[model samples]
Target: MTTTPKHDERIATMTFASVYPHYVTKVEKKGRTKAELHQVIRWLTGFDDVRLQELIIENVTFKTFFEQATINPNAHLIKGVICGYRIEDIETPLTKEVRYLDKLVDELAKGRKMEKILRSTS
Candidate 1:
């Protein structure tokens, strides 16, 4: 999809690797584990630890990183406001996915249960 005149092109260009460290810091400062952060990321993107490290080392753009993902089918269940926008209402697919990741990380930092953050497929 063309992230042209309408969508925020900045997020599209920002490397996932650059944002990754901040995510780690956010969770760690809140007394959460890095492993838990990784788990949430894996749930959203379907990237294992090995593949995730490769993407981080490659410094792939958010667009490229998500393009390569097998996003969870239940990701649609992710709801509520994130960064001022309702997750389910976001029109841009890439932006929505990024927000979903953000919401999940926030949940982890807030001590939300893993089962709840991952959501239910049933």
Candidate 2:
């Protein structure tokens, strides 16, 4: 079996709350609202506002956060490059999911409309 990369391991162990602020900052700098960020996160993770707040307050790791998530079926539709890595080319399941979130946020920051960022429903 292949060992997980050190980068993936480090990211999995990092607190979701720690990374969340960076996500917010990125989008806000590009004129996206916190509500839009929340919506994108909810769409991907299946966590409502209350549950998201609970996770943030608990300081869970990215691994724990995704483990608890009821990820959307539409998540597979998120395909693109983020930070020089292609989201679709990521072989690790957990890492791909994490990058999907990152790609969505990047799209929002780049001013893609909400409907397109969310992907096709049908």
| Residue 99 in model 1: lDDT | 86
Q: Candidate 2: lDDT over CA atoms?
A: 0.90
In candidate 2, how many Å is residue 37 off?
0.4
Clashing pairs in 2: none
Model 1 regions lying over 4 Å from their true place: 1-7
lDDT tens readout by residue for model 2, 1-122:
22259868987888999999999999999999999999999999999989999999999999999999989998999987786778778888888888899999999999999999889564
TM-score of each model, in listed order: 0.92, 0.93
Estimate the overall C-alpha local distance difference test score of candidate 1.
Answer: 0.90
Error of 1 at 96 (Å): 0.5
Candidate 1 minimal-lDDT segment of 10 residues: 1-10
RMSD of 2: 2.4
Candidate 1 backbone collisions, by pair: none
Off by over 4 Å in 2: 1-4
